[model samples]
Target chain A: MTGHPQSSMPGQKISIQASQLGKTYEHPAGSVVALRDLSFQVHAGEFFCVLGPSGCGKSTLLHLLSGLESPSTGAVTIKPTSVGMVFQEHALFPWMTLERNLSFILDQQAPAQQAANRQLARRWLQKVGLEKFQHAYPHQVSGGMRQRAAVARSFAVQPALLLMDEPFVHLDYQTRMQLQQMLLTLWQEVGCSVVFVTHDIEEAVLLADRLMIMSRHPGTAKTVLQNDLPRPRHLLDLKTNARFIDLVEQSIGVIRDELQAVD
Target chain B: MRMKDFAIRTLAPLGAFLLWELCSRSGLLDARFFPPPSIILYHLIMISPGEGIFRDIGASLSRIVLGYSAGCGAGIATGMVMGLSRRTRDLLYPLVAMLYPIPKIAVLPLIMLIFGIGEMSKIMVVFIGSFFLVLINTLHGVVGIARIHHQVARVYRISRRAYLRHVVLPGAAPAIFAGLKLAIGYSLVIVVAAEFSGADAGIGYLIWQSWETFSLKSMYAGLFVIALLGALFAYALEWLERRLIPWRDDRDTREHHDA
Candidate 1:
């Protein structure tokens, strides 16, 4: 049932490669080691989740991949193409209208496509159920709505690799579930590589094709686990599916052990 | 409730005026110094457009516009330079900090010597008054821009010109407008005081001339006009500010939703 063309290939194309990535932040008090000698690869059209506890550098890995920050000691390689990011903060330009926020990224097209790009923006906003709020400012919307807008904005860019740092972490459970499904649907439609960072084990299980778990205190990708949960998995179906529960429990067990080891 | 709010708002000033009128009419207060609101209004009308009041107002406005525009232009430019470039900020910030607190009135004697007690001197005084206020506020605004904004811009690979145009300018606008508001009030005060030191035509000159001749009523009229001008200036700035910061009022909605 996997109709995703890129993933259908037996030898999946490596879209992103990180090698010995390290980040150390220096403050007045002392130095803080964020990520140490981290390395990973994300396949084309893959939903790759980076799972870890807080300060375990899941976000640092996203940053390095997105080139939002330079690694202190390593390199990341990506197939030359457009990239989009949905930060935990949403980072929607508050001064702009929602339509304008999406257009700011979308409207970077040829003069002929300018009108089409705008229409595309409206279509994407409609997909996120924000068509009516296209003119509203960021502060005028609810947190869930703003996150949806942020998600819509990122997807509107039609990026080759979409890096998201727990975009739904701040939403309520119902909102989070709804957004997660919306994101998965959009991901399948776009077929772009995603490197989503989150701390929630259930979220990781729900969304990822495979997930990397990072160990705390001088963080490193401790393990990479595969999720063989069947495709087109409904949100409610995951609750009763034994394999889904097993995957979540396995991830939680590993994380718990890592937390204990760190202490 | 709305009507009551309006009534309450209107009555405070009206009540004060009535008490002042009673005090003056009953001879309980000195009319020479503390004239009733009616006597001040009568003198105000007598010195309206046909009289020298319009000329004084026009002269004061021209000086303010000229001085305030020059100062704001210079301040915003230099402040942006200081904000974006550390070298410039390091070089100029100390000097600005040292000079910012020195009253423009204190420099009037020196300015008069350089610009020679003419319109240039008065304008210079007003310029100095506004320049520091705008420069400091604009610098603070730019420096206070969130790191996340820069990260977002970089991640998007936005052009330097576009970043400045879209992000920096709008981000700094609220603080810049605040500075402008303060500058306008400061310019008004400085221009008036500068006129008093030496000027032939201005509200400050009118007030000074009236005081010298013991024309209490005209002095009160000049004061009233200046007060009105101040209110108008403040109201205009606030109106402009509201237009620039469209997100400000929406913050109430966000906070309400949060609660």
Candidate 2:
């Protein structure tokens, strides 16, 4: 358990550390365990991937890490900074326009000036290539555009650790790849630690600096694989890169073994 | 296309009214009971300062304004409180449930006895009717907001006041508008009914007195006025709803709900 958040070992370049973390939801029939003794560390400025199958509590882990839900057991320590998250559903406030969504977060994170936030929100939208659709409501635009705005809103705050829960799972193949590249570019620019959870091995392998593979049924980290692929990885370049292919295959094997062990 | 649509809408209703007038004038319909439109129009045109028609309309409208405002205000406040806190919902929900189902008109006799045959009695009936409708809808609006939205607010560190203003209020607005619209029609009905029994100074009284005095044209005139008022109120509320919630789309994906 953590004694104090800031007084912890943040000086050691650990962006976030979760030790002996577990979560059990209390229901009418019985209590369902979602996470069990899941321990991991995301270093400062690292792209950490939590790869697991559906129902493996990858989302619950993200929730726990983001301080949305408290762990039933153990503790999560992080350098105190406003955390930003992207959900599978985009989770942009549907009522708010694209610009307002970014500005809403900016207002809370950077309470400088209204005009400054407006300019910053516009800049963020421009970065996501959504400047033209700044006044458009979430449903007014296409799904990809909405997700991009969501991404912009998350990054607008300039978070210390960004948590993504299968953020591109709903997009079409082309959009998904395009967004994956966009995410890499943004991550490269911001240099923030990211804990991305996804079921797709290829996506995890493509994005993660270190992939943490989780076993199913009350998810626990089975193994953590280091991605030795070279930096500034383009999706097109990654396709021909033998190391990328190898990492995907390696992560797939680990996931397959995890699924097999349970059966 | 828009002009054609407007023409069609206006012409269809005009055609029906014309047919009714023709039928009544041609002796196919009873003019005594179902008076022709032209005579009702004449009676409406004849309305003036001395005729007490304006006073009746004024009496009815003031009751609606006072009661509906207070009722909707109380309902929304209570609903928002209940929506945000489970403890408040647990405490107030059953009380609301028990109280809401009882028809306000049914309590007219009781209210008249307590509040007396005055403005308070009339206004109170409308208030009760409006309060329940708005409260329930506002509660549904708040509770129905996606769990993910709440999580978004927390994860982004949205302050409680800001969350309520930006999320909860707007989130519940469509449903609250639905409730407000229902309450308008209900308020009109309750006011008219309350006036029917105890008052001598409303559209209801005008209609009732005209009937007793065998002034069928005036009675028809009262009915016509009520119809016009109903349309006016509905349109006003609809306009307000459109202004407040610009993103109320029928075809919006279910994943992202009402603003």
Candidate 3:
């Protein structure tokens, strides 16, 4: 389901670099620290997953990267352009059909080149196996299908950096696996960089080229694991590998300990 | 199944009309004051299409259309400003609160003095009555749009115009439509009342004239016309709702079907 070759290749080295990034919320009582002096780098064409316990500001990091919120301190920079984000909730415009949602991103581009944009969107929709459901409204489709459409929309613009915040957290296990496979296929086809934030250790280990686990609230990077798994990985084969399960268990263990310490 | 549901709905009205006719004919009711459906229908049929009655219907319909459109437009505009801006809310809330409690009909005489006893006065009365309800509802609707949706729009880097077009309007549409539906009912009621008091050519005027002439059947005919018009307007809005917000209907259908 691959389309034409990349129009322009991304740069080598760090595509996105964050240094001393921090976010604090000022409440009526006082300030609550969400992230403090957090720094990370995502290379171009890499699947980087940020895994942590709930309330660990993993989503906060993603939000900062997505330009949804400003950091309290420090800076984050990406070479090419702003990042495209996929929310945990499939933030599809409920007013629009799936095709129209994709068209919206393309429409934001130059108007005179719309025919080309439409063709690009159609290619991406087919890449996600949503060609049959292009005319369907978001509400009319299943949750997994909606998320796939969301992915298609985010990638349709060929963003330099893609940020996903626990996008498959709400789906059933089977649907989540299927979508994970679809996502990998799309990423391979497009060669776009992704910064996915998830609480699921299995999801993190299965999809990420490099997985970074975060500590408790006022989050900081505890460990960064570079997954040396082979490319064009199959989900079923990846699951059967002992190394995959070991990685998942180790990350889950870290998260559980963090939860207990918080309690 | 659909036909069965339709028949079941029609049964109640049909039975009530039959009972009314039977009661009037059996001398169980005062026929002078309480004319049966048969007499009302007779007068309705007897009234010529080109006669003054149709002209009265036209006048009443026109006044309602004008007043309701004005009220809805002004109300939505003002309400959006008030709801979206803290300064506007502070400036207008006190005045709205003070005026909301006063029955619009209570100021009919004052309105007549200001706008005169012509159509202007009646339409002004209707507008005032309808506007406040629509404004308050629309304000609440605007205020009720989830903050999270605005955040999503911000993340997308949607331009201000695109944000309003894609997010705010759709998010607030259900509430706005709800308000409009209520405002439509208010307009129908107020317009008739205003027409009843002074207008010379409206359904309400015809009703008053019939009452003066002691023609109960003709009065009931006018009342019937008013009811039909009100129901028609409501149905029309519902049709618009189905068309404009089809997603809402689809969501509801899927939810119930899944359940």
Candidate 4:
């Protein structure tokens, strides 16, 4: 399914374009296909969520889009100058304190304006509600805090495209919701295109402007669903919305069938 | 909070020393042979600080610093090359395996013949002794870095420098530190042994001289100093490890059944 373009011009609307993206891994058993002939476009400043079962190549697609991994076949082209990524594991540098982790990325930029970079990092940390924990190491913080710090670090770099691979998978329900809201708020504030991968249908419904569901083993996009939910969505309000539940149930049904086929 | 833990931890060493003093005073143990902690301390103090002990410590420490630094530098470089590239790993792994088992100390005479009975021989011995442990540890550390980290760096289009700084170093830190700690310990062992064999100055030389003269108290004092130096070295590495890789402690507890 396709929705109305948010912008009039093609150049303005498209942020990322993937053509026939595919990835295959060689194992002792034989070649395992993760993605095959996957193609999609993510619009600028839009939150796009890829929904799939556990073994599906949803995360693989995210990696390829972020240039983290090379696709065996096909290509992903991004209009953005650079891509920022948040991993499922939080991938926070254990050796660095939260502030230093952000600074490390900032330090990569031309060394002339380090003070400005540090200020930007501090601002990002504050945006993520982690200002108090800036000095804390990743190990010292809670799982949710660590993920928030990871997100903050990614955002501090100001990449035009953000890739999130199940970034909230490790958090408890309440923390996940809080982080989901924070992510949406941050995305709105930054106005950068985001491609988020997740197994949770509710999370996708709550966060994504458009959701793409995929089948497992040799993953391919099965359906793309556009959500007409209003912006500035509250977590409680989304849960109570009938359209949200219907979309979630519909996605869940597709995933269930995909799981059965795999079994 | 941590200070209390530190005090409690010191209790065991204090108790051991107390037991040693009591046993020696009661004549249950030969003070001449074992030397009570107090007597050893007194002997160490009565000896002129500049006579030879300080010189020996200085000489031994310099050799260790030089040898360990060189070995660690080479080991880390070799390890990264082998770990990152399949070709290098294939070429070097077999050679390392073959040489690793050959006790480095066994080649001391050969080393002495080649480098002579000078500081070079002693330093080379320490280098060989330390290099293997560091190399193996570094190799394993680099190899063990999670593939996901590499992917993350790739996603960011991280430059080679950034990749090494962020992905490689942090990922391999725990293993590298483990190897470093082991290499430092091996350095101490080999350096002392090398000194014992032929050194004109060093704590090891002092021990040998005392033994020849049947100065049992002085020998025990030298032995005690050696043990103290070894423990101090190990403790210093542990402190550095804690400071440099704080995350390792947390990761260790989470990954292992025993923290």
Candidate 5:
């Protein structure tokens, strides 16, 4: 499926571009293809998500975008700015406290600005409602709290792009909803392009400006979905909104069709 | 820890000592081999002012301290090299596996033969004992760190220095500390065994001399000193671990301890 330049901010400057991307892993027995001929572009400040069934290579796609894994074919190009990422696991440095976790990113700043980074870390922690736990180690906080810190850590770096692989999948339903809203709020504030990958149709509908539906293993894009859901979407309200419901039904239909085809 | 917890911690040792004292006094157990706690205490007090015990302890301490630090420093460096590279680990694994299993004491003769029957020999035995344990544990520690962490470092473009100081070291800390504590425990055993045949002034030699003359009190004194040192060292290590690895989640008790 081809993706036309979807609506983003007025300028719509490109943040990341992935063209004909593919990845294959070689084991002792044989090489297994994870993704193939995948192509997508994320506009600056766009909240994009990849939705797929299990074993659909969504993670491999995100990893390739993040440059964590190299694709056997094609390439991903990002704007000249530091990239930020979040994972299913909170991924906070276990030894550092919430404050330091954020500051560790901002430490890339000039030595003169370093003192400000510590204060900036505390401010970011405050934005996540974790100011009280700023000094607490990741292990010392709740799983939800740690994820909040992880989100804070990512956004604190002020990246031009953010890549997340099912960042809230490990969280409970309630915490997941809370984090999703908090993530949206942070995105609005940071104005960075995001590529969030998840298997959950409702999650993609809730968060994505444009959703890429991926086919089963060795994943290729099945379709590019335009989410018409309005901004500041609270889960409770989104559950009842007509547009949100329509987006969900459409996403489920696309994925259901892909899964049936796999069988 | 509360007073109750402290009391509970000390209960077993105190109870055992009391029971031993009672058994010796009542003649249920022979007093010759298993002297009462009071007799050992009395002998320890009498020997406190003497230079012999101090000199012996100093000799053993110097050897252990020198050897253990050297071994652990080298072990950590080697472990990092092996852990970071598959090639290095593959090259070194068989060599380590071959040397690690032979009891460190069993090779004391070989060490003494190479280094000579001097302080170097005693220290080498301790070094050999601690080095392999630290190396293996450190390698495992580095390997055990989740790959996601390394990815995070790369994604964020963390500096090489920051990556090592913050992510790599801290991630591997608990395992490294475990290795260190284990090495200390092994060092005590290896040192004593090394001194058994060597010409010298060490706690092990003191124990050997007392054994030959049938100086039961002095022999017990030597044993008591080693035991005391072991207990102190263990407690010190635990305290240090708590300080260094305060973030360590006692996995089993995480739920219970969560605020």
Candidate 6:
């Protein structure tokens, strides 16, 4: 399916582009293809979500875009931009405190602005409601809070592009909702392009400016749905809204069809 | 609960001491060889000034400290090389494997021949014992760190110095510290063995001298000090480990269980 370039911020410039991307991992037995012929572009300030079933190579796609993994077939071209990424495991330095975790990124991103980075680190921690926990190590905090810190860290760098590979997948439902809202609020403030990968249809519907539905294993972009849900979406309100449920069901229908086709 | 723990902790050792005293006093064991704790204490006080027990302790301690530091420094540097580079690991692993298991004291005669029967030979024995233990542990620690950290370092574009300082060091700290603790015990064993084989003034020399002269009480006193040193070193390292890696203790209970 082709992306319609549906965006919340109209006339925003292109932030990332990838064409005919593919990734293959070779084991002792043989080579396994993870992704193939996947093409997508992310607009500036756009919240682009990739939705797929597990093992669909949604993560491989994100890794390729973020330059964490190289595609054997094609290339990903970022628009001379800095990219920040959040992994599914939160991946905060276990040895460092929450403040240092954020400052580690900030200090590297803006070494010349040391004092400013320290202040920004504290402010970012506060934004995630973790100012009190700035001195606490990553292991000292709950799994949910660590992921919050991870989000804060990605946003703290002020990258033009952010790649999130199932950041909320390991979190429980309650923490997941809280983090999603926190992410949306932070994303609004930063206004960077985000390529969020998730298998959950409801999350894709809620967060995506344009959602790419991916087919199972050796994933290809099968459908691209433009989310027409109104802005400033809250989880509680969106659950009750008819249009929100319709969008969710429509995305679910696409995934359901893919599952049946696999059978 | 606290009272129960205290009671068990104190009573167990105290009870053992009382039983030992009773056995020795009642002539159940040879008093000459297994003197009562009080006699050992008395000999400890008598030898404190005349025989210079403190000087012997100082001598042994200096050897251990110097040897341990040198071994640790070399071990960490070599282990880093082996852990970070495949070529170094390939070159060093076989050599290390061949040398590591050979009892360090077996080479004491050789070390004495080369370095002479002075402090150098004793120190070298301790150094070899600690070096191999710490190097193997440090290598394992460095190699065992999760790949997630390497990816994180690349993604964030952390400087090489900062990556080693922050991520690599701390990630491998627990393992390295474990190695250090084990190395300390090994150091003590080798130093004592080296001294017993040949030395003028050390705890090991003192113990051997007392035994040769048939001063059983002083021998027991020396034994007491050696036991006390082992406990003290273990406690000291445990304290340092807690301070350095405080988060390890606070880590999730489930994760601790898994480990």
Interface RMSDs of all predictions? 1.6, 3.5, 1.9, 3.3, 1.8, 2.6
Candidate 4 structure quality by residue, lDDT tens digits, A1-263: 22222233456578888878889999999999999888788888989999887878988787677766789998777898867889997487777788877887787764577888878888888988889988887777788888998899888888888989999987889999999999988889999989999988899999999899988766888888888889999987789899888988888876776666663
TM-score of 2: 0.94
* Tens-digit lDDT string for candidate 3 (A192-237): 8899999888899999988888886577777778797788899989
Query: Candidate 5 local accuracy as lDDT?
Result: 0.85
What lDDT would candidate 3 get against the real structure? 0.82
Report backbone clashes per prediction: 0, 1, 0, 0, 0, 0
The list of candidate 5 runs beyond 4 A from truth reads A2-11, A109-112, A261-263, B47-51, B249-252, B255-259
Candidate number with greatest DockQ: 5
TM-scores, in order shown?
Answer: 0.94, 0.94, 0.92, 0.89, 0.95, 0.93
Question: Residue A83 in model 4: shift from native, Å?
Answer: 1.6
DockQ of each: 0.62, 0.47, 0.55, 0.47, 0.67, 0.50
Candidate 1 lDDT, B1-259, residue by residue in tens: 9999779978977898899999998899988788998988987896555558889988999999999999999888888889999999999999999999998999999998998988999888888888899999999889988887787787777778878988888888888988999999999999888888679999999889889988888888888888889988998988888987887665765778764
Residue A20's lDDT in candidate 5: 82
lDDT of 2 by residue, B1-259 (tens): 9999779878976898899999999998988888889888888878523568889999999999999999999989888999999999999899999999998888999998999999999999999999999999999999989888898999988888889999999888888999999999999988888888678799998888888999888788888888889989999999898888987664456436422
Q: Highest TM-score among the candidates is held by which one?
A: 5
Which residue pairs in model 4 clash with each other? Answer: none
lDDT of 5 by residue, B1-259 (tens): 6999999989998999899999999999899988898897788769633738888889999999999999998888888889878999999999999999999888888887899999998898888888999999999999999988998888888888888888888888888888999999899988887888875788898889888988777788888889988888889989999888888757447756644
Query: Residue pairs in steric clash, candidate 1?
Result: none
* Per-model TM-score (chain A alone): 0.92, 0.93, 0.91, 0.93, 0.93, 0.93
- What would the per-residue lDDT of candidate 5 be over residues A105-207, giving only the tens digit for each residue? 7885544688899998999899999999999888777889988998888888887888888989988999999999999998988888899999998899899
Evaluate residue B20 in candidate 4 and report its C-alpha lDDT on the 0 to 100 scale.
99
The reply for model 4, stretches above 4 Å from the true place, is A1-12, A259-263, B1-9, B47-52, B246-259
